[model samples]
Target chain A: MKFCSVCSSEVKQRIPHGDNRLRFVCTTCETIHYENPKMVVGCLPEWQDKVLLCKRAIEPQYGKWTLPAGFMENAETTEQGALRETWEEAGARVEISHLFTLYNLPYISQVYLMFRAKLLDLNFSAGEESLEVRLFSEDEIPWDEIAFLTIEKTLRQYFEDRRKGHFEFHIGDVERRVK
Target chain B: MKFCSVCSSEVKQRIPHGDNRLRFVCTTCETIHYENPKMVVGCLPEWQDKVLLCKRAIEPQYGKWTLPAGFMENAETTEQGALRETWEEAGARVEISHLFTLYNLPYISQVYLMFRAKLLDLNFSAGEESLEVRLFSEDEIPWDEIAFLTIEKTLRQYFEDRRKGHFEFHIGDVERRVK
Candidate 1:
């Protein structure tokens, strides 16, 4: 940050008293601006043997296929955020089952929380942030064209767990990028 | 936020185009400052049949007892953040086992990720942000003097799960207060 959001004064990167890491400290007000990782909540909406996917209509991988997800907002639970994203991105209603994946992407400062959910009905369409939305069975999934590694990993694990006749929570870190 | 950290200009809250919720948008620079929930990483540090707790020396519950936790910083994983907090608050090294509880405090825009951990050695003391640190068995816990509801709930669940002989991951929301 170039300036302090609280006082609008210039900021310097320095470790504060009793802290180990460097933070943006304001010159005038001495306010420290701390940035933390964000939670990206989404769901793997399922119907019969298929899962819902949205084609992104925005930048940073536009037109790529991804599970319905987005940055979680305030005043909502993670499951609620996942449901909202599913409804908003794919216009689909889903009944959330359980949290399936907790992938920490330290490089991007994001934690992806994906849930296993059942689609309520066939009444679905592409929302504002999606160019198209469709349901694909395991055999029909466009695995080669998936949007992100986290999504790919979650999808793979979901199918594997399904074949095993039991579902379990999975947690791991993703270090795909160095920066 | 009153001013934009990017350009040091005044920010106004408005619903940006294509977004349902209002955001702090910079009028002069047209920058949208999105605020998301942050992760508070901590651990239930165990030594034999007892768990460690810290008495806060900081504001917002100065003398109340709590598990060692703080906001997850950049360039670190959730587990790392929890370990760092444990070492910093209790001056104890711990071996984290598995994530035990994921509590969403939506009212305060924070998510608490507590892990199950084992104390490495007997060399432990209170850190700067803690007035005192002590180990307590389940029956010896100070149930009335707990600092936060989430911490209390986590501790209760941990003991219950232990009694049941099966520990499972927990995810829930806490709406104690509003901003």
Candidate 2:
């Protein structure tokens, strides 16, 4: 931060009074600014054995297919964020299973959490953010059209684990950029 | 949204020429707008079997103590985000255990994810965002000084679970406010 939040004075990364390492310390307010990344949580809704995917009606990754995901709401858990996003984007009720895949993109400064979810029913319509919403069997997935690399990686890992009957966890950076 | 991102014209929520629920439907552009929330992740780092805590150096709850937390960076996993925050604020490394707590607060439009982390070591110092940092035994926790309600609740639940050896999982704040 260029200015201090407390006193509005110029802030700089300087050594702490008695420490050697650098810190974002404000000379006037004598405080440091904190930096944090944003969170994205969603679900991979499944029915029988097929997975749910949504076609984006918006930009950034328009028309691309993806699992429902969005930032966490103020009063929600990671799972609720996942379920709520699924409902809003896919019009589906989902019961979340175990913690599923976690995709990291350090360069973007964001983390994407996807839980394994069971599709409660097929009742759904185009979500405000979706151009199309449907379930895809393994063979029906539009792998090339997936919106983000993290989603592609997560889905790939999920399928691999399913094939191996292994439910081990996975975490990696599609890019190391901090969001 | 009444206006389409593509056409920049008014859109209708109801299905055109039919009875259906509301959605962001663009007539001219034929595109929908989708908005999603961001995610925030953090960790509960423990040292010598005691949890480490940081006094907030910023507001919303300035001066209150909390487990170190920040939003997920562009491409970090929830676990990575949690671990990063702990290390940055406390100058400590840790081993992340199971995700012991998940809270979704829709009112504020954010989700809080917390993992049980064992402090690999306690050599720590205050980061820029921390006014002070220290390890607290279970009974010595400074309950009222915590920065967020989720932190307090997470600690209480952690202690209880540790007591019962209840390593099983269950989501928190299904109905109550996440904060």
C-alpha RMSD by candidate, in order: 1.9, 8.3
**DockQ of model 1, rounded to 2 decimals:** 0.84
Summarize candidate 1's per-residue lDDT along B121-145 as a digit string, tens digits.
9898999999999999999999988
- The model with the greatest TM-score is 1
Residues B57-109 of candidate 2: C-alpha lDDT, one tens digit per residue: 87778898999887655445678778888877777788988776766655556
Best-matching candidate per lDDT: 1
C-alpha local distance difference test of each model: 0.93, 0.73
Poorly placed runs, candidate 2 (over 4 Å): A1-36, A55-64, A70-81, A125-132, A164-171, A176-179, B1-40, B55-65, B70-84, B95-99, B126-132, B142-147, B164-170, B174-179
Q: Clashing residue pairs in candidate 1, if any?
A: none
* Tens digit of per-residue lDDT, candidate 1, span A49-101: 99999999998779889999999998888988999999999999999999999
The TM-score of candidate 2 is 0.64
Q: How much is the lDDT of residue B117 in candidate 1?
A: 96
